[model samples]
Target: MNSATPLLEVEGLRKSFAGVHAVDNMSFSVAHNTITGVIGPNGSGKSTTIDCISGFQRPNAGRIRLDGRDITRLTPQKIAKAGLIRTFQTVHIYEAMTLRENLLQAARPFQASGWVADFLRLPGMRREVDAAMVRADELVDMIGLRKYYDAPTRILSYGQKKLVALAAGLMPKPRLLVLDEPVAGVNPTRIREIEEVILNLHAAGESFIIVEHNVEFVMRLCERVIVFVGGSKMTEGDPKSVQQDARVLEAYLGIPA
Candidate 1:
């Protein structure tokens, strides 16, 4: 919460399954309002690291700080409530629901109304609904999904559905958004659109930690890149420097040293 503190920090993070270390003493920090990318090869602990940070998996030993507050042992729901939102590798939109409904549902947890109020349609509930709708409208427009606002998400293309998911994540205006493989299955053109959307959002004061297998995409979007190898941070620097590092080539890209 100090102006100079990193938005998120992980210190000596370590996790293992049956004695096999997934993230071994990894330490990293994501600066506020900056796009940071994490890239690694197979079995390099990328998945486990994010899982620990996001609270899906607890670390055997480590500390995770968000907004300069310790959140290392919080539950997934608690962590989400703390404003560290993470999207999955797969699309998470509700196919049967309209695009508008999906975005509104994403904010249900933050509405400050109890189920009794919601069921009875109380004044507070109604006011929250109106406010959520305004946010939904802004986000739908931002993601360029306004035309499909009332339409069921089931009919949208895979790329379009992904966009809907992105918009839903923004509905809460989280302190930091951790994107997991956002462009993994998206097409080339859609990838560019996603990139532009991220840049626009960053310009508007949003920060992100992107975990992606697509090195080229990460290089284009992130200000700093961290390469993981042997379950720890192998090297970290600007995209150009990380890309040219021989260790990254040998360890991540599978090119012989």
Candidate 2:
């Protein structure tokens, strides 16, 4: 693990609404090629924190860095270009678009094709399309949604839609992917599948910051787990240690023992 420079870092982040602080002086870091899990109860600021990181919502105060460059106030599009991608708790997929089309669209921003080239059907545009198609195929298969590659996403189940969103995020091959509640409403079997998909991606050198409500899922999947309570980071450590923390049990996650 590269300890000198983290892949992503957030320090002294603060967000508020109507005089209520959703995240107060939040701070953390995610190293390259490692998965870090963030867990907290409702209103603990897990989602709010990620929103700020991903540029969905601006923070009242803080610093966010990606690969040592500040991205605290950058737009979401700019942030994605800097190698950070995020998936929402609610699956965000084009219901009428074919799964393959959805994935390709997500990758368009990173492709070499310009608007002029695409409009003119230039060779560069075609080449980029071919490359994106290849990546789409790989991601679709990884998510076990190959059969739905040509099907409209609206026909998929809720869990299946979540998988599509995950795949779309991977199409960009981001430096860090933040997943918000990856398995929130998923069934046990679907959750297991999602776990396998994440493991496969991790083995291939992807880094992630997963903000999930499922304590067991986070514990089972992440190497390090950070617990949040009442909008601030309570503690962070290995999964086992975080799971056994008395404060975490009594406050957020229920006692496991």
- Point to the candidate with the largest lDDT: 1
On residues 70-119, what C-alpha lDDT tens digit does candidate 1 reach at each position? 99999988998999998888888899999999999999998799989988
Off by over 4 Å in 1: none
Q: What is the C-alpha local distance difference test score of each model?
A: 0.92, 0.91
What digit string (tens of lDDT, one per residue) describes model 2 on residues 26-82? 988888889899988898999899899999999999999998889999999999998
RMSD of 1: 1.1
lDDT assessment of candidate 2: 0.91
- The number of clashing residue pairs in each candidate reads 0, 0
TM-score of 1: 0.97
